[model samples]
Target: MDFKVREVVPHGRNYALLRMMPVKGEMPEVEPGQFVQVEIPNSKSTYLRRPISINWADRREMWLLVRRAGAGTNALCDLPEGSRLSIILPLGRGFDLSVRGNVLLVGGGVGTAPLLMLGKRLVTLGVDVKFLLGARTTSDLLQLELFKQTGETRVTTEDGSMGHRGLVTDHPLLTDGEIDHIACCGPLPMMKAVAAIARSRGISCEVSLENMMACGIGACLCCVEDTVDAGNVCVCKEGPVFNIKRLKW
Candidate 1:
């Protein structure tokens, strides 16, 4: 679907919240943890579209929390309202919403983008949802109140500028042994540590991978991830989200 930029709100210095609406048809069904490949307009250097997580989506609009990591992403962040951008959306499998349990959604840095929608969906399903967000400083903890509206929200900052003064794993909630399931998205190391903690507690866990992607479909084979069952599959197709057990990590 091609979506027109509706708004771009900046967060601190490096991040921007993008709001977009479909150019023609009604919005397609988008699942939390699924992503979109966005076409960067007027960029000579960026040939491939960037895969951005679907932060929040509805029938009328789509939200993307973009980090200005490169020239391609910077161009996207600078887009004006009404600029049309092509997007291949709601791609890849999302977190399982069926299980009834005390669930924790963990995110590090901009990885927190996907969890808001996941939390909102879980809330609607009458499932218990809690969020654990981590950042380097309090300034990096964007949209804390929004997550709190869905469930109990906690924060961890490396500099002791937020709720807790360490990693999300260092938070008391992770050691409580009450969490039945966990859905996490973040840097590889953070996700790995969270998955390990979940494994130690025998809790079911899923992690969304921030893999390098090109086609946003199975064809490119650019985002291949090795798994225990499947030899190597494209993250754009087989995942972006996977069970902790399925991963070789």
Candidate 2:
């Protein structure tokens, strides 16, 4: 389907939130944690594509919260409004929404985008969701009020510029036993910490791996991750979201 860039907004210091209008056709039915491969022709060498998480998706339109991490993202950020970009939406498996009990959502840095959308879904389904958003500094934080609208919220920053002076695990949600299910997407170490805490507490938890990719589909072998049960799992095909019990980490 052809998606048109409708609007663009800056998120954090290095990221931008792109709002795109979906074209009429088979709309990509994406879960909260899935992503899309965007084909931008802003540069010559960075051709073919770059993979970006579906950050925040909805029915008619969805927002992509992307940080300008490198060449691909830089090209995307330079796109002007009304530009037509080739994108494959909902290209991968997403978070498991069926287990909608009390959910504690955690995200760090640019990874918090998808969790914001997930929190919204959880609230709509009557599942309680508490958020722990972390960043290195105040400038790294994104979508504060947006997630707050979903449910109760907490925040942490490594430099103590905003919330607690520590990692995301320092947030009350991790130490508090009230959380029923935990869902996380963040830096590897941060996600590991949250996942470990959830495991220790015997709470069901899920983590989305933010792997670098060329194709958002399973065609490329770039996103393969090692697993305990399944030796190799494709983040784009098998899942970007994995249950704590299943992952080797």
Candidate 3:
């Protein structure tokens, strides 16, 4: 599907939120947890199709919260309004909205983008969902108001500058056994921590990973992850999200 570059809203010093204007208002035909492979025009070799988390999608417009951390994102930031970009969207499987009990959603950095969308979907589906956004500093915590609009939102900054004064794992939710189901996306250590917490409580958990990919499809076989049953599975094809129990990590 074709997605038009509608508007770019700068988030922080390094991040910008992109709004995609859908042709015929047919946006959001995809799941909340899905993603789009976007290619900005005139991007040099350093810039190319980048995988952006599907922040939120609807019939008219879709938003992507992207951090200008690298050449690709930097090039994307230069795109002007009304500029058109090519996109292969709503691709890949999303989180399984299976049982709807109390759900714990944990996110770190840009990984939090998709989790926010997931939280919205769960809320719309009438599933109890709570979010815990974690970052090294307050400056790194983006989209506080957006996350607040979804459901219960909490933050944990490594520094005492904001929200909680330690790692998000320090949040009481992880230790209280209050989360019926756990879903996490973040740095490897953070996700691993959440996984361990879930394991200790015997609660099933799922994780969305940010792996390198040469091809968005499985042909390149670049984004492979070691799984319990399937020795290696493409993160883009098999999943960007995987059950904790089945993952080798």
Point to the candidate with the largest TM-score: 1
Query: Which one wins on lDDT?
Result: 1
TM-score for each prediction? 0.98, 0.94, 0.95
Off by over 4 Å in 1: none
Q: List per-prediction Cα lDDT, in the order shown.
A: 0.91, 0.82, 0.83
Q: Residue 122 deviation, candidate 1, in Å?
A: 0.4
Ranking of models by TM-score: 1, 3, 2
Error of 3 at 172 (Å): 1.4
Between 1 and 3, whose lDDT is larger?
Answer: 1
Clashes of 2: 0
User: Residue 54, candidate 1: how far off, in angstroms?
Assistant: 0.5
Which residue pairs in candidate 1 collide? none
lDDT (tens digit, per residue) of candidate 2 on 97-192: 876667888899998988987888778888878888899998999988888887888889899988889998876668775877888999899889
| Candidate 3 per-residue C-alpha lDDT over 49-97 given as tens digits, one digit per residue, 9 for 90 to 100 | 7888788887788889888878888877767888787887776777878
Worst 10 residues of 1 by lDDT: 171-180
Candidate 2 regions with alpha-carbon error over 4 angstroms: none
Q: Rank the candidates by lDDT, best first.
A: 1, 3, 2
Model 2: worst 10 consecutive residues (lDDT sum): 21-30
Candidate 3 is scored at a TM of 0.95
